[model samples]
Target chain A: MPHLAVNNLRAKYGALEVLKGVSFSIEKGQVVALVGPSGSGKSTVLRTLVGLTPVTGGNVTIHDDKIDYASSGSLRRARDQMAIVFQQYNLFQNMRIIDNVTVAPVKIKKRPKDEARADAERLLAMVGLADKLNAFPDQLSGGQQQRVAIARALALHPEILLLDEVTSALDPELVNEVLDSIRQLAKDGMTMILVSHEMAFVREVADKVVFMDGGSVVEEGLPEVLFDAPKTDRAREFFGKILRH
Target chain B: MERILEQIPRFFTADNMALLLQSAGLTLAMTVAGCVIGFGLAFVLVYLRQTPGRWALPLRVICVAYVEVFRRIPFIVVIYLVLFFIQTVASNASLFTIAVISICIYAIAYTAEIIRGGLESVPLTQMEAARAMNFGRLRTLVTITLPQAWPVILPPAIAFAVSFIKDTALVSQIGVFELTFRGKELNNQGYSGILVFGTIAMCYFLMSFPLSMLGQYLEKRLATPRSEQSARKIRRT
Candidate 1:
């Protein structure tokens, strides 16, 4: 069974529907890259999955347990099993990097302070931020901040991770450091669903590429097939415009 | 001017000085009581305004109404209303009770608005980040939002508190026997206006100056960039 499945997911912000019956599934170890143009509901899908966007319709199943989007308890339970890294690195500005990584485990999971701190140290080490543990978010470069965010997400021990344009906000030269950390996670078999505009990074790291447009999946397949061959005129035009840029 | 300066020494006679001291004590007591009560009510008002739910909606509307009505009216009028209004309900209400309640009622409206501004100054993304980390709303508010909002909240609150110190003079209208009331009595007894008024004004200045200085000091210290603070702390360690 798929580790996570989003079936007929519908979401909106007041009158405007952003995700219209979007469906996708991720197995336990697969990295699914969601690629699309701006406002194509790619990021909305991730937001909906995390229960930030109120789901107007449909259901999500995690590990074979299904729940409606409106149930707070079930949604929170589902959310506790996953984590997200945003386009803007929303680190707690008041906290040191180590505290930022450890806060969730200690507060939400009720882990002991020492255990949480040790876990945070280990995760910081994993993300190449061991020396910066005492630093604040504002003290670091954008790439370092994003890497800290990734370590924070991993600190939760989420079964699946969500990356919403993680490197899009970085300077071009700083993009590789964050993408490299994500690539290393992919190598270590961390399941992640990423929404990205960096077609090259998506192609390199994504095992299965899903093409989205106008709030629906246009085409999805292996990266080689989707990138090289045209299954649909819309996707082909999208790739043509993106690659030409 | 020479006569006024000479009179200042006579104003410190034992009886006059004792009344001035007692009145100053009362003024300090009223300011402290008003701040404690007003801040508590303002906290409730801000929480109601910010929280989402059907139950909180009416309470929030009531809070908005409370802030608007109290803020728009004069503090002296509120004091008069509370003082006279209390007499109709209870003939023997203490001046202390009337003074604290009136100042608190007036300060709550202003404090609520100032605190709401502080709350809004915190970025929306901060709350979203906290929620995504599986934090409950209360924990997110106390731990994540309040710490960031503190720097923004403090200066205004201190300003209000110092203003409350001056505002306590208005309570003298209801025979609270505070500094200004004692000044009026001393003036009635043939004390020079310069001596009586100057003494009360000096007392007011003494009370408010330290608080304003503290506000300025905190604004400068907290205004330093978070990264700079962390770096400085790291160096210290």
Candidate 2:
């Protein structure tokens, strides 16, 4: 059984329907990359999955547990099972690097401070930020901030991690550091749904590539199948433009 | 100067000194009580943004009106209005209680606005990040939002305390014998008006200067850094 499933998900912002009847599922330990042009609702899928954006209509089930939008308990449990790394690194500015990672564990999970701190430190070390345990978010570079965001997400021990254009905000030089960390996470078998325009990173790291255009999945297949052999004219055009550079 | 020095002992004789001390206590008590009430209400007003339903607007409007009315009215007029109107209903209440309660009412309104500003200054992204972590609304507020908001709120709050201390002079109109009121009484006694007023001014300065310094220190300490160290730490680790 798939670890996560979204069947016919529909979401809107007032009258503007951004995600219209979207559907997808991820097996345990699979890395699914959501590729798309700007304004294609790729990020919306990740946001809706976390319940940040309310679904107008749909079913999102994780580990065979049905997520009911109306039930606070179930919704919270579903949310806890997943973590998201934003396009812009969203580290809590007030907290130190380790504290940013340890906060959810200590405060929400009710773990003791020492235990949470240790876990946070370990996660930071795993993300290559061991020396920055006491440093604040503002003290780090953009790539460092994104990695701390990853570490912060991992500290929760989430079943799935959502990456929404995680490297889009970084400088050209900083992009490689963040993408390298993500590639490492994929290699370690963490289930990830990534929304990105970095075609090369997506091609290299994604186990399955999903191409979306205008709020719908335009094409999807194994990275090689989608990139090398195009079935749709839109996919062919997109690939032609993306691979040319 | 010699005449002023001689008059100091007469001016602050036992009974008068007692009254002055009592007044000082009342002034501090009023300031503290008002600030507490104001901060509490302001938290509610600002947190109303997170509350569901259409009534949030009405609640916000009412809070705005409370802030506007008290902030516009002179503290002297407010003290007199409350004393004259409320004394009829609570006839046994002491003048000290009336003065403190009036100050509290006035201070709460302004403090609420100050707190509201602090709460608003916290970026929405922080709250969203907390939510993504699956923290319940209340827990997120306590741990993430408030902790972050406090550093921003403290400087203005300390500034408010300085102003509140100075505003205590308005209580003299209602016959509170705080330093300013004592100075006025000494002035009425004649011969050392400049000395008495100057001493009172120095007392106000002494009361406010430390708090001003504290506000400046906190503002400096809480300043947000420009670099993104979290990202760097991530790379190094």
* All candidates: TM-score: 0.95, 0.87
Instruction: List where candidate 1 sits over 4 angstroms from the true fold.
Output: B1-6, B88-92, B231-237
lDDT of 2 by residue, A154-237 (tens): 889899999999998999999988888888889999999999889888889888998888877888899999998979999999
Candidate 2: residue A244 Cα off by (Å): 1.3
Task: Give candidate 2's error at residue A205 in angstroms.
Answer: 2.6
lDDT of 1 by residue, B23-52 (tens): 898899899889878988998778877777
In Å, residue A36's CA in model 1 sits off its true spot by 0.5
How many clashes show up per model?
0, 16
Docking class of 2: medium
Give the Cα error of residue A164 in candidate 2, in Å. 1.2
TM-score of 1: 0.95
Model 2 chain B poorest 10 in a row by lDDT:
B224-233
The models' CA-based lDDT, in order, is: 0.89, 0.82
